[model samples]
Target: MGRYQCHLLCRWFFTQSLCSVIVQQRKTIDYSAKQNLLSYATESSLDHLGYMTDTPRLEAQSALTTFEFRLSTVLTGAYTIPAGTQITTGNNVIFQTDVLTEIPPGSLSGTVSGHALVPGVSGNGFLPGQINALITPLPYVASVSNLTESNSGADQEDDDNYAERIQLSPEKLSTAGPEDSYKYWTRTANQNIKDVNVYTPAAGTVEIRCLLKNGDIPSDELLEQIGNVLSATNIRPFTDHVIPKKPDKVDYDISIKYWISTDDKSRATLIQSEVNKALEEYKLWQRSVMGRDINPDEIISRFKNAGAKRLEITSPVFTVISEIQAARERNIECTYEGLEDG
Candidate 1:
């Protein structure tokens, strides 16, 4: 059952006027007609003979959870270690060499880099000088020092993310071979890809830039997979050459001042909390899609609606960039400039 069909069903079960009102005010209704419609259409229905439609699963993205550490050795002889040699942390988390390295003849130590063999977000978010213990004890290997910082591990996708992707399926299916096609294909590869910008620089060349939801760089493996999928004959025209790349990230700094009538510390705190929440929501809305300009008016409206007595935006005087670029909010700073006299 689609929305129209659900509406008809609703009308048949209830009064036509009531069903129309429910459909119109679905946004506020606890049991939204749109949601009910999706449930009926995707799930089993008496008219459809109880066959459930397939839904897209939420994708899990791997974070670079481990960092490369320099290995210092006291052994006074040339030694060659093959690529993929395992090095273990004190907690037994495994790391593998990214490339083969050879200690020069008569050299005491050489530099080598490794990454976590296991994917997904886990382990203590270790910083430099944190991982000192090695699982495999070797006399030649004297000490290990992390040269770079390790990112905290991430978990699998949640239900809310899964539903959001499923909602985009209808629009994706409607697109033919335009920019929307590239966006749809990229999203199919990974749901964490929040924004995709497509540019046709030449007659035969298409560039697709993607931005991750978590604001981190996409891994090389993920980029390769996207390239492979887009290169398929059925997915893209043979005459067109596709380039998959990451977008240039631009961060926005926001400062807000709002007035409130109350002088009570707790009441002021509550208003500040609401304003902060609204700003966070605005950031999400701004980055929800690609090629969206940063509208300062929207921010002002959001603050005013958050019970601000008088609102002034000191930063982001105007829209940041055109729709061609992908922009993300790096941080937001809000201040309540004392109570208002009104």
Candidate 2:
């Protein structure tokens, strides 16, 4: 299937409506627990009927992916970096892609990825991808070689005032698994969303990270709002399915438990509708992995540490721009590198 599936990963996600869920399936070919469907977690069914998928998902890159865009100011010498690290303006070739000195400043080029593959990179657009250090004799083109290339005459044009807009991709767990094109999504659920693994009686568990948003909502109304989200979305309503069987005291299936948060800012970080759906679609985990349960207070504490002060879970298209701009404003020294499949 294509990277995007018809499975409604997200419905109507707007302001503070962003969310990402990591789901692992639980093993349900039990001999006994299939007989007791009592607790929301304990397995009572004989087969893995209600569960979505099985297999813990790792990203296309690392568990934690970081993408940065850097731009430096040059007063005299020329500067040429990766193609994808710059911003852009209207019909103008604002940025220069050369390695000369004294950049008059117009635009810097930037790049993002389509998948594990980086598109046609003759080095015109943002050509950064997840590649490693060291190449056999690095070479830079001192002059143009293509006749079809425009601006063959603007070699000395000023380029300081304009910014080149580039797309940037990050390293991820996608390096594993087939068709594993996935990015880290933030959750924007309510205090009710949590890691229910603690509720389980066993160790083989599913790592669940639900992101939510509570930046603008009032303290008194947060839980209620979260409740609305849960009820609105039927099957994916932050719930767990149970199946049962043999010798175990009380077997837990795939469903996790809980609600975690402490304050408004921290509480703003919860899971959203689509993220939960993505976890189901990706089927990242095996059916045997169980979900952990957590309370509101604990979830809030963790988000604060992640540098999320004012949180909202909506679809932030400019998320990449923020990183690019931050690097530009602060004048950090970073190469225009991006994500690669290897």
> Which candidate should be chosen as best, given TM-score against the real structure?
1
In the range 1-342, model 2's lDDT, one tens digit per residue, is 553643344344432253332111233434245443322222213123222222121112101111222233322433444432222222222222222222234433222221112111122222222222211121231221111111101111111100000000121223331111111111122221111111123332212222111111112122332333323333121343211111111111222222223343233334323223433332222111222121223223433343233223221112121110110111112111212222
Question: What lDDT does model 2 reach?
Answer: 0.22
Model 2 worst lDDT window (10 residues): 160-169
Q: Per-residue lDDT of 244-310 in model 1, one digit per residue for the tens?
A: 8766566677877778776444577787788889888888777665566777888888877876778
TM-score of each: 0.62, 0.17
**Pairs that collide, model 1:** 121-153, 121-154
Best candidate, lDDT: 1
lDDT for model 1? 0.63
